[model samples]
Target: MWFRRDLRLGDNPALLAAAADGAEVVPLFVVDPTFATAGTPRRALLHDCLVALDTSLRETGGIGLVIRHGDPGDVVPAIADELDATSVVVSRDYAPYGRRRDAGVADSLADHDRTLRGVGSPYAVDPGQVRKGDGDTYSVFTPFSKVWRRTGWQHPHPAPGDDVRWVGAGSTGVVSDPLGERPVAGCTLPEAGEGAALDRWRRFIDTSGASDGSSRSAVAAYDDLRDRPDLTGTSRLSPDLKWGTVHPRTLLADLDASGSGEEGHTVFSSELAWRDFYADVLFRQPHSAWENLNPKLDTIEVDTGKQGEEKFARWCAGNTGFGIVDAGMRQLLATGWMHNRVRMITASFLVKDLHLPWQWGARWFMDHLVDGDLASNNHGWQWAAGTGTDAAPYFRVFNPTLQQERYDPDGAYVERWVEDPSEPMLDHRVERTEALRRLKAVTGR
Candidate 1:
């Protein structure tokens, strides 16, 4: 079993499939240089995740996880040829780079008379599966979500049954040096790995049982408190989800097992749909990863040049001075995460208030976020910049101060992150006006 994002052994469809193929399934993890250099926070978290996976595999199956570095196209086939394995199994990859890399590996395997097979994916509903009755990909989230719900998903595949045999594990050492060992100067990251992921999920539900739908307590309040950044209202699960420590199917199943009729459950499920939606969008249009989904916003002038560089530097350092924007950026800079509402606010501030290109901020996020999946991060930035499919309309620029007044009602969130904020970089009102003017100049819609 080749592990990419799916680090955990539980509820992993591909691993189970590999085990079903009979005993002595070799588990391998390849550390690609590109993936490792992507960012510091995720790099560190990924290392911890791999360590956890090694421990879990060792304790559960008494197998060693083969750690490799460099190109998988060569490394995977080399390992398969060495083991004389008939096939290599992995969860499907939807990201452009991952897809290409897997394809290359598959070809190499085929040359050696071996097969590279895919099972389920990291998502409940894999991308390129859900579509409209017309059979075209849905660009708008709501209609896509409707069809996605109607299509539903398969039950999570069970873990490897007890008494399964394993092979070819205890050989090479896992990578010790990740991109960076330290997190941002003052940022605190959550505990890493599968155990930590399950623990967080258990606490969020505030109930435990293999089957007890009526015992749920915490999720019931999700809809009420999810938007409040001041309180621990959200499930802090994105990073885990990104790493595939816990699958979306697992979460959906547990939510169902905990009674699915609640508004909180429905909304949280929809959020998962949104994640899949962005992945689907990127799957169909790989260019959208770095380019605009909507062309109208392409002509808009951004504050780029030396002045823009300095402004961007301030934003990256969380010195923007707008209370909520500063706090949110600091939250990201310090930690590799930010509240969703604050994400939108800070994104809008970067694109509209700072008059910078959305790509600048998006790149920064991909560098900082432990959960930065390219599809979600880039599309989300586009949504805020009004340059994406079914995006926030251009005229609706978010007012950061007003957002703080509304979401950070008690100022607790802002105060927590921005101990000594810099002066307001620019006036929001003036920037908002200028933003509208720029949009009008480009599209005239």
Candidate 2:
């Protein structure tokens, strides 16, 4: 069984089928150098998840995960050849790199007369699956969301039946560092493995008090609280979902059973749908990962000179004079994640104020965030650049001062991360006007 993003075993279609096929599964994870070169904080988190997975496999009386460091295209086939395996199975991945890499592996395996099988993705509704009646993709979020909710999803599969016997891949004499020995600074990552995911879900639903009354009621207030940076209003499940620690289908099923009303449930469900929407957008248009999504806007000017670089460096270093923008940047540096609302504001500042291209910000996020997904990060940057489907138009710039006044009215969130923070300055209006003028000059808008 090849493990990609789908780390956990329960509700894992590929892992379940692999175990059921009664093949001595040489559970494998290839640590691609490409991932290491990217060097995000999430890299450490991924390593931690692998350690947890190895532990789980050990408890199942298997040889634990086989860790190989190389290009997956080269290593996967070599490993398969060494094991003399009949087939390789994995959950489908939609990212451009994943798609191309998997194809290379498939072609290599075919040369060895081994079959490569792919199960459906972790998503309840695969990207591009829910489409308009005319078989075209939906560009707008509302209609896409409406169809997504009406779409059918598969039920969670049970853990593989114990009747399946293992055919162990003989010792390759490779030893991996124990999970307990890995050192990470100040990372309180969630437990890794199928059991951990289930346990977390149980704790959330049972203790959260959302299940007691109505499902819709519990999440109905989410729309309001989700925007509050200081509150734990939104579900802290993005990292879990990103790593496939929990299946999206399972989450949707739970929400459905809660009988949450349409409005609240719909809003919550739309966030989930955004995941697929971005994936499909990226899958169909990989170039958008580095360029503007809308070609006509490719001419949108940005500063890439020494001054621009210095400003971008300050933005990344969380030294921006604006309290709210700096706060969001610092939060990401400290915790490897940022709230969605702040993400928009910070992105706007980078592109509009600093006049840096969206790709620069996207790359920075990818190198830091635990929940940094290619589709989400790239599409999000394009949206902020006003060059993507359903984008915030370019003219709709986010005024950092006004935004802070509106969202962080008390300056609580800003104060939390800003160095030696004070109340909004008495001459803040004058400062904001000057800042806006600088931005207009730099962006030529």
Best by lDDT: 1
lDDT minimum window of 10 residues, candidate 2: 176-185
Candidate 2: count the clashes.
4
Candidates' C-alpha lDDT: 0.84, 0.74
lDDT of 1 by residue, 241-343 (tens): 9999999888888775233488878888888999999999999999999999998788899989999999999888888888888888888977889999999
- Per-residue error for 216 in candidate 2, Å, reads 10
User: Candidates' TM-scores?
Assistant: 0.94, 0.87
Alpha-carbon error at 286 in model 1, in Å? Answer: 0.4
Q: Model 2, stretches more than 4 Å misplaced?
A: 167-196, 207-220, 257-262, 422-445
Give the per-residue lDDT of model 2 (tens digit) for 66-183: 7777898998898788778788889999888999999999999999998778887857788769888889988777787778777868888776555545443234544443333343
Model 2: pairs clashing at backbone N, Cα or C within 3 Å: 24-167, 215-260, 216-260, 216-261
Single out the weakest 10-residue window by summed lDDT for candidate 1.
Answer: 171-180
- Deviation (Å) of 252 in candidate 2: 0.8
